[model samples]
Structure formats: structure tokens, C-alpha cells
Target: MKILQAPFTEEMMRSLRVGDEVAINGVVYTGRDAVHKYLHEGGELPPGVNLRDGIIYHCGPVVMKEANGDWKVTAAGPTTSIREEPYQGQIIRDFGVRGVIGKGGMGDRTLAACAAHGCVYLHAIGGAAQVLAECVKRVRNVYLLEKFGSPEAIWELEVENFPAVVTMDSHGGSLHAEVLRHSQAALAERV
Candidate 1:
């Protein structure tokens, strides 16, 4: 398994290819549809939040607040990624996002952005929220809690060995497209 650490750089992102298993050790921000739309329309990230060469996980985590006001993540599964296809490319370009973590996959526009911007799309396991939350080491900070609420808020998370697989690479490779092409060919033959 390839190890991806903090300060994820262009070279590191480019080195990853489709089907590569990776364990990410660093900070990843939780972003849902609300976050995507907000950023797409030029909304500012919470102060001190930057996406330059950073990873954005498409998740609406299940979080619980503890005494002393510390938050704990009870579930952290990946959300369907295709829904963000419209804004993903733009977000990747505009914010310099190096990696995206989500379930399923994205379309050509996002793939093109990854190719152009040295970014990669990492596919996390679906239906594995509780298991995935084990990788989260800390809940550093959260933003937009008032406007977007917990699920849709910007959650800054520190993680360790968060496992994922590269489904789309910066070199114009997409496992999702491959699956679609193969499925189409099989359907044509059957008909």
C-alpha cells in the first residue's frame, strides 16, 4: 500500500495511479454538497482553511459532542461522489485541491481537472462509516456549524492511515470510465 502524508504535493498526487491502495496520514477536510456548492459560488472557506494541495473528503460524518465541548466522530463514511461532478473540477482548480476522497467516482470534467491540476480521486469504502471513523485521530476544528449544521459543516480532521483506493489519477486514468465502457460493450453483445 502506498503511504500519503501531509503536505500532499503535485508529484505525490501524480505518482498515484488508478487501483493503487493508499493509506493517507494527514489532515483531510470533510466537505459535503453544501460545502461544494458554497465553494463553487466563490464562498470563502473558514478562516485559516486552505485547500492548496489538500485533500477533501466527501462525507457528512456522524459526530457527537462530549463534555468540555470536544467533538467525537462516530461515523465517517464516504458519500456518493458523482453528485458533485458539476462543481468538483472547478473546486479542484480554484482551490488547488490535491486529492478527493469519496465513494463511487466522478466524470470527465473532474478527470480532466485532475489531469490538469495534478490531483487524484480516492475512493473510500461505502457502508463502512463506523470502521472508517477509526482512522480519525482527532477533530481539530469545525466551521460553518451555524449556517450548515454539523453534517454539512466544514470539519477539519486529523487522520492516520486512512485507507482508500485511487480510482482516478492525475494521468487521465479513470476506473469508472473503464467500467462504463466494459458494461456498454457487454450490453451491446448481449443485445
Candidate 2:
């Protein structure tokens, strides 16, 4: 329910079944697209940085300056997960990241990796960026600025009660696949 880091045990991940709503507390990293490519391509993360046993967030926030000109998140929703399909599984294994937060669903390869690695994929609500931003206490820091542009930069966030649902579990259960199968079968009956 409340965790600061990943590399969580298999029992912890399994206890959190697909569709179990959760509120996360503590630190997390934001990364997507270009970051994934760079990591998989053997480009080392800047020195002193390690994602091992951390949670990676698939998000690109809309940030704004406060009255004092300090940047604050305006909209901070999860990104479509399918884009990372190409690199996710390998990244997870290579980097030792134990959790991923994104919108929508990942593919079979990612699901398989989760099973192999005792990881979990969490899905945050798609259109609730502003609301989610409210939960972010502060933008602790950022990284990977040059290649990925600002959007692809990694944001270190401090959060409290940040809402999400478990969509994929370490046991090889996938809420996304289950939902799709049910939808397809229902459509077939109508046709």
C-alpha cells in the first residue's frame, strides 16, 4: 500500500492482484520513449544514477511556473504504454526496475518479463493528469535533458496517496488481456 522503492518480493507483488487499487507513497522516476531507447542501446545513465530496485513512471507532465517562478506540475497523466513495448521487457531485466506505471496495457513480452522478474505493471487513470499532479508533493529532480527533449526527461517525484491500479502481476496475470478477451467475445456474440 505504501512503498518507497521497488525490488519488492514476489509475495508482495502477488498479493497485489490485477485491478487492486493502490495509493503509492515515496519516490519514483519518470521515463519514457527516448529514455528507454537510450538505456537499451547501452547508453549509460548519467553517473550517480541508478534505477535498480526503483519504479519507472511512463509520464510526460505539463508543468507550469508558480507565482515565485518555481516549476510545478499542471498535468501529469500516464502515457500510452504500448509505445514502450519494444524496449520494456529488456529494460526491466537489464536495469532491474521492479515496477512500471503507465496507462493502457503492455504486450505479451512485457507480461512475460514481469513473471520472470517478480515485477508489476501499474495503470494510472488516463485523463486525470491535473488531479494526479496534486498528489505530487514536489519535483525532486530530472535527467536526460538533451536527447529526449523536456517531455522525455526523467522526473523524480515525491508523492503521497498517488492513485493507480495493478494491471499486470508477477504471477503472469494480466487485467488488460482479460478485458480484451471479454470484449472480443461479447462482440462476437453481437455479430
Candidate 3:
């Protein structure tokens, strides 16, 4: 397993191949459907918050505040990525975000956007809440708390050895589509 520290370059993103195990360390922010909508509607992010060259995780964590008023994520997992396909590509390009972390897979438009914008889609394992949380060493900050509920809040986390796979790459390579094609072909033989 290769441990990758972030501020990942475009070359690094393009170099990742399917089946290559990797751990990512750095700041990753959680954003979901509602957040995307807000952003699309020209909603302003918190002061000094920049999406450019950052990683956006499609998640809505189950969090609780500590006695000292510090927030802690009880459960953090990737949400279904396909739900954001319509806005994802545009968002990525507009924000200049270099990487995206989510579950399931994105579609052709997103793939094209990745290729055009020099980005990659990282796939986190589904249902691995506790396991993923172990990678989150700290919650650096958060935003959009009251307006969009927990789902839309962007929690910035400092991660260490966060495991994920490169499912969609900037070169127009898509593991999900390839797997689907192979499965269809294999099933055709049986029929």
C-alpha cells in the first residue's frame, strides 16, 4: 500500500492506476448535494475558504460536539457520487479543485471535466465509516452550519493514511465503466 500525502499534483493524479492502493494525508473538505446546490446558486463560502486546488469529499458525517464545543465526527463515509454528476464537473472546473472523493461513480460529463481540468476522482470504500475516521486525525474547521443542516456543512479534516482507489482518472479512464463493460460481456456469453 502506498501512502500519498496531499497537495497532490496533476501528474500524481494521472499516474494513479486501477488496483493501486494508496493512502492520502492532508486537508479534505466534506460537501454534499445541498452544498453543491448552494454553491451553484452563488452562495458565498466562509471567508478565506477556497476550493481551488483542494479535495472535496462527498460526505455527510454524523457528528457531535464535545463539552468544550469541539465537533467530532462519529461517522464519516462517502455518499453516492452519481447524485452530484450534474453539477460535479462544472463545480470542479469552476472551483479548480484537483481531486474529488466519493462512492459509486460519476458519468461521462464528469470524466470529461476531469480530463479537461486535470483532476481525478478517488473512490472511498462504501460502509467503512469507522475505518475512514481513523484517517481523520483532526477537524481543522467547518462552514455552512446553520443554513443547510449537517449535510451541507463543510468540515475540513486533516487526514492521515486515508485509503482510497483511483476510479476515474484525468486521461478519460474509468474503472467503473470498464468493469461494467466486462460484466456485460461475461453475462452475454452465458446467455
Candidate 4:
């Protein structure tokens, strides 16, 4: 598996191709619908939260607060990435984001942005929230909790060997598109 971490560079993202399995270690930030819309609408990221060369995970993790006021992620599953298609491209360009982790893939706009901005879209496992949470080594921080609630908040996570498959690459490759193309052609042949 390809190993990835924070401060992802253009060269690193460019080298990845669709279908490459990667193990991402280090920092990642969870950004659901609210967080995406907020960022797209020109809202500032909380102080200390920087997305430059960073990875944004489309997830609404199940978290628990401890007696010490620390946080724990009981589950970390990917949300449907298609929901962010309208804002993803712009977010990648404006925020200098290098990676996006989610499920169900995205649209042409997002793929184009990945190609243009040296970014990659990784498909995380669906229905494996608890299993994936095992990769989360720590809860670093969180933002917009009071405003957007826990699930919709931006959660800073430190992960180890977080697994994902690259469905869209910076080189204009998309496994999701390929699957759709082949499926459509097969259906047409039957007709």
C-alpha cells in the first residue's frame, strides 16, 4: 500500500493513479455538509485549523467525550462524496487541499479540480465505521462543534494506516467513471 501523510506535495499526489491503495498516516480533518458549505461560503476555518496540503474526510464520526474532557472516535465512516460535488472543486482550489477521502465517488467537476490542483480522491470503505475508527490513533482537536454540532463539526484526527483506495487521481484518472462507462456500455449491448 502506498503511504501518505500530511503536507502532501504536488509530486506525491501526481504520482498516485486510480486504483492505488493507500495507507494515510498523520493528520486529517473531518468535514461534513455544514463544514463544506461554510468553507465554500467564505467562512474562516477555526484558528489552528489549516487545510493547505491537507486531507479532508467526508465523515461524521461518532465521538465520545471522556471524564478528562478528551474525545474518542468510536466510528469513522465515509459519507457520500457526491453530495459535496458542488463545493469540492472550489474548496480544493481555495484551500490548497491535496486529498479527499469519502465514498460513492464524485462528479466531473471534482475530478477536473483534482487534475488541475494536484489532488486525489480516495474512496473509503462503506459500512465499516467501527473498523476504520481503529486507525484513528488520537483526537487532536475539533472546530465548529457548538455551531454545527458534533457530527457536522470539523474534527482533527491523527490516524495510523488509515486505508483507502484512490478512485480519482491528479492525472485525470477515475475508477468510478470507468466503472460507470463499462456498465453503461454493457447495458447498451444487451439492449
Candidate 5:
């Protein structure tokens, strides 16, 4: 298993390939469709949050507030990545994002973007919300909570040993596309 820390460099992204298991450490930001749309439409991010060479998580975590007024992530699972395909490529380029964590994979546009922009897409296990939450060590801050609500808000999180597999790579490798192609061929043969 490969270990990756935040503020990934271009060389780091290029070294990854589809099917590589990875353990991620450091900060990651959460954003779903609403947050992506907001950013794509020119919404300004909250100050002090950086995206350059950063990791973006396609998640809507269940959060709770502690008595000390600190937020805790309860359940954090990856959302379907395809839903953000339209904006993902652009966002990756615009923000210099190096890694994306989500489930269900993405499309050709995103694949091409990864190739061009030195980014990778990591696939998290679906239905493992609670297990994933264990990786989150702390919630640093949350943005757009009032406008987008808890799930859709931008959550800045510090994590340790977050597990994922590389499903798309900067070299234009995509396990999802290969699987789809094989599945389609098998269906045709059965017909």
C-alpha cells in the first residue's frame, strides 16, 4: 500500500496507478454537488482554506456538535463521483487539486483532466460511513453551513490513515472505463 500526505506534488500524482491501495494522511476538504456548483459558478471559498495540491472528498458527512462547541464527524462516506463529472475537470484545473476521493468513479472528461492536470481519483468503500469516520481525527472548520446545510457544506478535516484505492490515474488509466467496456462486451455476447 502506498502512503500519501496532503499537498501532493505532481510527481506524487503521476506515480499512482489504477488499483493502487493508498493510505492518506493530513487535511482533506469535503464537498458535494452543491459545493461544486457553487465553486464552478465563481463562488469564493472561505479564507484560509487552500486547494492547491490538495485533496477533495465527495462526501456529505454526518456531524455532531460537542458540548465544548467543537464539531465531530460521525459518519463520512463517499458520494457517487459521476454526479460531479461536469464540474470536476474544471475544478481540478482551477484549484490545482491533486487528489479526489469518491465512489462509483467518473467519466472520460475527468479522466482526461486527470491526465492533463496531474490529478488522481481515489475510490472509497461504499456503505462504510462509520468506518471512514474513524479516519477523520478532527474537524478543523466548516463553510457554507447555513447556505448548504451540514451534508453539503465544505468541511475541512484532518485525517490519519484514510484508506482508498486509486481508480483513475494521471496517466489516463481508468479501471471504471475498463470494467464498463468488459461488461458491455459480456452483455453483447449473452445476447
Candidate 6:
């Protein structure tokens, strides 16, 4: 598996290709439908958060706060990425996000945006919440918790060895598209 650090550079994203297994380290941010919709509708992100060259995760993690006020991640599995399709491309472009981690894959617009913006979409294993959470080293910050609620809040996290596969790359490659085409062809053969 290729090891990657957070705050990825454009060159790094461009170097990645579909099907490459990667283990990510450093920081990543979590956001879901509400967050995407807010951003897409011209809502500004909370001040002090920087997304440029960073990773965006489609997830709703379960977190617990300790007696000393530190937060612990209990579950961090990926959410379905397609749910954010309408806003993903624009979000990547606007925020300069270098990587996106989620379950399943995105659509044509997102794929095109990834290619155009030097971004890659990484697919994390679904239903591996607890296992994934183990990779989170710390909870750096949380935003919009009151406004969007816990699950829909934006979580800034520091992680190590977070496993994922490149299903969409900056070079116009998409494993999801390939699978769709093959499935359609198979259906045609049956018909």
C-alpha cells in the first residue's frame, strides 16, 4: 500500500491512479449531506478551518468526550458518496480539496471535477466503523455541531494508516465507471 500524508499536493494527487491502495496519515475532515448542501448553497465554512490541499471524508463518526475534555473517535466508517454528488465537484474546486474518502463512488460531474482539480476519490471499506476509528489519532476540532447536529457536523481529525483505495483519480480514471459499463453490457447480453 502506498503511504500518503495529509495536506496533499497537486502533484501527489496527480500521481495517484485508480485501484492504488493507499494508507493515509495526518489530518482529514468529515462532512456529510448537510455540510455539502450548506457549502453548495453558498454557506461559509467556520473560520479557522482550512481545506486547501486537504482531504474531505464523507462520514458521520461516533465520538466520545473524555473527562479531561479530549475527544475519542469510536466509529468512523464512510458514508455513501453519491449522496453528495451534486455539491462534491464544486466543493472540491472551491475548497481546493486534494482527496475525498467515502464508500461507493461518485458520478460523472465529480469524476470530471477530480480530473480537472487534481483530486482523487478514495474508497474506504464500508461497515468497518470501529476498525476505521482506531486509525484516528485525535479529534482536532469539530464545527457546526449545534447548527447541523453531531452526525452532520464537520469533524477535523488527525489519523495514521487510514486505509483506502483510489477508485477515482486526477487523470480521468474511474473504477466505478468501468464497473457500471461492464454491468450494463452484461445486462444487454442477458436481454
Which candidate's TM-score is highest? 5
Q: TM-score for all predictions? A: 0.97, 0.91, 0.94, 0.97, 0.98, 0.97
Assess candidate 5 and give its TM-score to the true structure.
0.98
Model 5, 1-191: lDDT tens per residue? 99997668999999999999999999999999999999999999889779999999999999999999999999999999999998999999999999999999999999999999999999999889998999999999999899999999999999999999999999999999999999999999998
* Model 5 alpha-carbon drift over 4 Å, by segment: none
Q: Cα lDDT for residue 64, model 3? A: 82
Prediction 4 global C-alpha lDDT = 0.94
Q: Can you write out model 2's per-residue Cα lDDT over 95-158, one digit (the tens) per residue? A: 8777899999899999999988878898999989988999898977777766677788888887
Q: Per-residue lDDT for 1-191 in model 3, tens only?
A: 76667777777777776666778988999999988888878877788567877889999988888999988887888999999988998898898888899999899999999999988899999889999987888888888888778867888988898899989889888999999999999999999
Is 2 or 5 the stronger prediction by TM-score? Answer: 5
lDDT of 3 at 46: 80
True-structure RMSD for candidate 4: 0.9
lDDT of 2 at 21: 83
Question: Clashing pairs in model 6?
Answer: none
lDDT of 1 by residue, 1-97 (tens): 9999999999999999999999999999999899999988889888968889899999999999999899999999999999999999999999999
Question: Candidate 6: what lDDT?
Answer: 0.94
Candidate 3 lDDT at 21 equals 72
- Whole-model Cα lDDT of every candidate shown, in order: 0.95, 0.83, 0.86, 0.94, 0.95, 0.94
**Candidate 6: Cα lDDT at 125:** 99
Residues 81-111 of candidate 6 have per-residue lDDT tens digits of 9999999999999999999999999999999
**CA lDDT, candidate 5, residue 130:** 90
